[model samples]
Target chain A: MSRAALLVLADGRFPAGGHAHSGGAEAAVKAGRVSGAGSLEEFCRGRLHTAGLVAASLAAGAVLGLDPVELDGAADARTPSPALRTAARRLGRQLMRAARATWPSAELDALAREFPKGAHQPVVLGLAARAAGLGAEDAAYCAVYESVSGPASATVRLLSLDPFDATGVLARLAPDLDRVAHQAVEAARCALVNGVDALPAASAPLLEISAEVHAAWPVRLFAS
Target chain B: MHLDHNHTHDGPPAVSADAHRPDGRRRALRIGLGGPVGSGKTATVAALCKALRDELSLAVVTNDIYTREDAEFLLREAVLPPERITAVETGACPHTAIRDDISANLEAVEDLEDEIGPLDLILVESGGDNLTATFSKGLVDAQIFVIDVAGGDDIPRKGGPGVTTADLLVVNKTDLAPHVGSDLGRMAADAKAQRAELPVVFQSLRAEGGVKDVAEWVRGQLAAWVA
Candidate 1:
């Protein structure tokens, strides 16, 4: 497996429709919880442990050659907010297009045929990693990093937070990101044996609740 | 790297820049309108909608910088039914959405066609940004770059991708040119010099039949697309 494949998949500019989404940072920012870099760190930390963990585990499972349709169902069941579900599917469709174009494979084609509208994004991301010849840990790292990167970048746009500050926040979270990625790969290994039930079910009530509120906003920068 | 487009569903997978839809029919001609802030891209879209609604089936996809303002404006004007207008949130990177990562805009246009849709044309309106903003060929068959006299007459002289390479360069608000002390002749001349033989239309929506030139140009584009 090529290490460069991980870099390509995890790059912030992968053009996978992640730019339009803020991963709940918009909602949290508007709710006055993620105003400053300090608070931004806290927000990323909470999201990293919950939503990020779940997404990473899913990606890892998919990379391990688990059934994508089952993983998609697991993704849907894990997602509580209708808005987030829609976003996940939309992102999935977008990632699917980019992935299919970049790395043409039978698995991607079959997935595209099955879920033309979309499956869950993390599933597609993991499969994209698999097609790119990346390992399960690579897929987990991509998912977990994306979980935080989306919000950190969005915060710079939303609160006019300094880019340096945002970068620093990410820097502080690096060790934790590594740990979460490892844990996610471990969970994927467990799920490979015990079924999808072995995957993590960490959930952030605030992120889910805020996503619903953000979706109803008549005016907002990020989609959600 | 497969330049050979396979429209057949049984063939190898293809995505991005495909001209055919999933149903084996051709997709509607997509024209992108991009310009700077307050350059009348939205207003031009509304006028185009009003002008061509009788003869053609049209839909609109608007990229709003921070809100659904452009899409709502089209709906408020009753230019098209609510179902035909889709707004894509740009996450403050309007240029990125249209030119770099066109997935969302493509999705919006595809969904519009799927919902209300054997349409003749789809106008993709980019959020007002800088002169550098332009649409990717993957997103639109043709593109119209709009600029107003108020922004500066030198916009033509200082041409960007939007001004120099657009299929059509529209010097909008020509009616305001005199009021703003702009040289219409110079703007036209600069545009001609920048793009030899490429079309440029000067329009002012306030004038009766002002969008006629643009409408006619759009008609020509649609005709050529079908041909």
Candidate 2:
């Protein structure tokens, strides 16, 4: 079941449209904010902490059978960028289609019906994960992995970097994925017990600015 | 603050029981066109609107990294009602908006659907990108990857995921094949070799009056959806 869930979530063909984006790596690369492998790692690490963490936590909540509506609202409040929020919700809708097709659960169907005015990806993914009968750890792992893989894959295409080198970067980040997943499960438990409003708020201003600037570029390689 | 005596219901009673449902009926099929810069993504979109607009309730969302150039082009051509076409300024990496985040595009699509009411199709045109660029599955129900003959017949041979895996691959500007010394047949063969059974349409938007073959395929997808 976990394997099937992973395959559905990780498959590039699933139709959530992750291929067009580079997380924020494209703008970071263009601005010289990320130049070499070291900077790439740092950028990924930062994302893993903020957006990645939030997504993982939401996914965990979904795995734990918490309310997706509340999780989606929390995700919206956490993601400050309108562009990012928009992207997440689009992905959420797509993910919903795929998840419902694969799992066919009442929880997923209900969440899809109740998806508020602006639902994003992580919340939907979490609910999908639960519907698939996966646990919080599994959902967290998928959320973090998807967030990082997008940029890692984009860097290879954008820079013409050796595929082996890109894989190496991903391999190095693997241990952190485990750590982040654990952290996410814990966070999710806290949020479920006390509500997402009780969780600490963290924002990444530079990344937000980069997304805005990247949006304004006359030409670009990635979407966001 | 004292409550008004005329108010029968006490201050905004909890949740509005009649809050309109967010998810309405199934939306029109959304198709995204993405590929390298100058690969004729806009021309393909315009041709699609011309070909399919009358048959389908259609709208377009064009992503321009900075400018609303593609939307402007569609408007200039009057492909659809001005209200049906929208532009998203992706601000940085066009891919991120289409791939990584996708919120703005989602809202644009939803807004279009809400305003138009029961539209049959929405086309999202991605900003120009490299060989690997592709639509997030979330963004479109199906996607078309456009590569012009001038970009080289070799592009198909290069074999990126977009070339090998997009639901449809459109080799545009086939009319320019002779001028550019490109082998349209060989390009088609190469694409088929890479994609196995997936379909490929070689189009000259200039000659064919806007991708009739691809437009037809889109019609088929919509037909299947209804079925």
Candidate 3:
């Protein structure tokens, strides 16, 4: 697997439709749980362990040769919010376009043909990682990093928090990020043997509830 | 290697400029309008829609920063049916949606085509942003950068990507030029210096047939696209 290819897949500028989304950070910030850089760090950490962990595991599972359709079902079960489901599938379709253009795998094409609307984004990320000459771990790392990075970047805009502070928060969370990515790969490996049911179903009720509220807002910065 | 072999060229494309629905029909020509806040990007889209709706099938996609104001305004004016106009939220960075990361905008255009398709043209209007903001070639067949005379005549002299690289530059609100102390001729000359042979249209939507030149330019683009 090429390290350069992994970087290309993980780059925020991957043109996979990530910028328009704040993950669940916009809702958290509006709820005042993420006002300043310090709070932003706490919010990212929470998301990293829960949504991030689940997403990473799903991605790693995809790389482990799990059925994309089944993994998509698992992803939907893990994500409770309908609005977030829409965002995930929407982003998945966008990533499909970019990944297909970059890697052009039959697997990616089949997925696109199957879910013309979209599958969950993490599932596509794993497929993209495989197509990019990357490993399950690379897919896991991409999912975990994006889970926190989306919110940290959005908080910088939402709260006008110091940009350096946001960067610092991400830097501070690197150790935790590493731990979650490692755990996700392990979970994926286990799920490969034990079945997709073994994948973690961690949920953040607040993120789910807040996502629905944010979706109903007449106006918002991020799409979800 | 397995990775290299995994991606055979025989499969269908993931992304391409020659976009097609699964059925193999040609998609509508996408044109983007970008400019600074209140420079009349939305107004240009409205006028273009009005001018071409009778002649050609048309739809619109608007990227609004933190609001649906642009889409709402167009819908309120009844330029096109509400179904034909879609708004994409830009997350406060309008340029990012049009230039750096165009996934959302692409989705909006494709969705419009899917819901009300076989259309001839789709106008993508960008939220108000700086001079550096421009549309990606992947997103639009051509782009028009709109700047009003009231913004300043020297804006043309301070050429950025939008001024030089845009397929066309529109100097809007010609009626406001005299009142705002702007020199239209000097602006046009500066525009020429910045863009060697590219076209620039001075327009005032308030005037009758104000968007005529731009509409004609768009017709030429659609002709080329079909040809």
lDDT (Cα, tens digit) per residue for candidate 2, span B1-227: 12234433222111111112134245567888999999899988988888887777889999986577888999999999999999875644677667765656776787787677778788999989888888877667788999999998899999997899899998988889999899988998899899999999988777756577998899898887656
Candidate 3 residues A9-112, lDDT tens each? 99988988888889888888888788888888888999999999999999999999999999999999888899999999999998999999899798998998
TM-score of chain A of each: 0.99, 0.92, 0.99
DockQ of each: 0.63, 0.07, 0.55
Model 3 per-residue lDDT tens digits across residues B2-111: 12334443444337565554446677899999999999989889888899999999999999999999999999999999999999888889999998888888888888
Judged by whole-model lDDT over C-alpha atoms, candidate 2 comes out at 0.77
> By the TM-score metric, which is better: model 2 or model 3?
3
Worst 10 residues of 2 chain A by lDDT: A110-119
Better of 1 and 3 by DockQ: 1
- A1-224: candidate 2 lDDT, tens digit per residue: 66776776666556555666788888888888777677778888888877787788888887776777777778778888887886677667656655666677777666666663425788778777777777788889988888788888778777777778777887899999889889988988887779877543556788888888876776665667
Q: Which candidate is the best by lDDT?
A: 1
DockQ of 3: 0.55
| Per-residue accuracy of model 1 over A87-181 as CA lDDT, tens digit each | 99999999998899888878998898889888899999889998999989999999989999999999999999999999999999999999999
Task: Indicate the worst ten consecutive residues by lDDT in candidate 2 chain B.
Answer: B12-21
Better of 2 and 3 by DockQ: 3
Task: List per-model TM-scores for chain B.
Answer: 0.93, 0.88, 0.93
| Stretch of 10 with least lDDT, candidate 3 chain A | A23-32
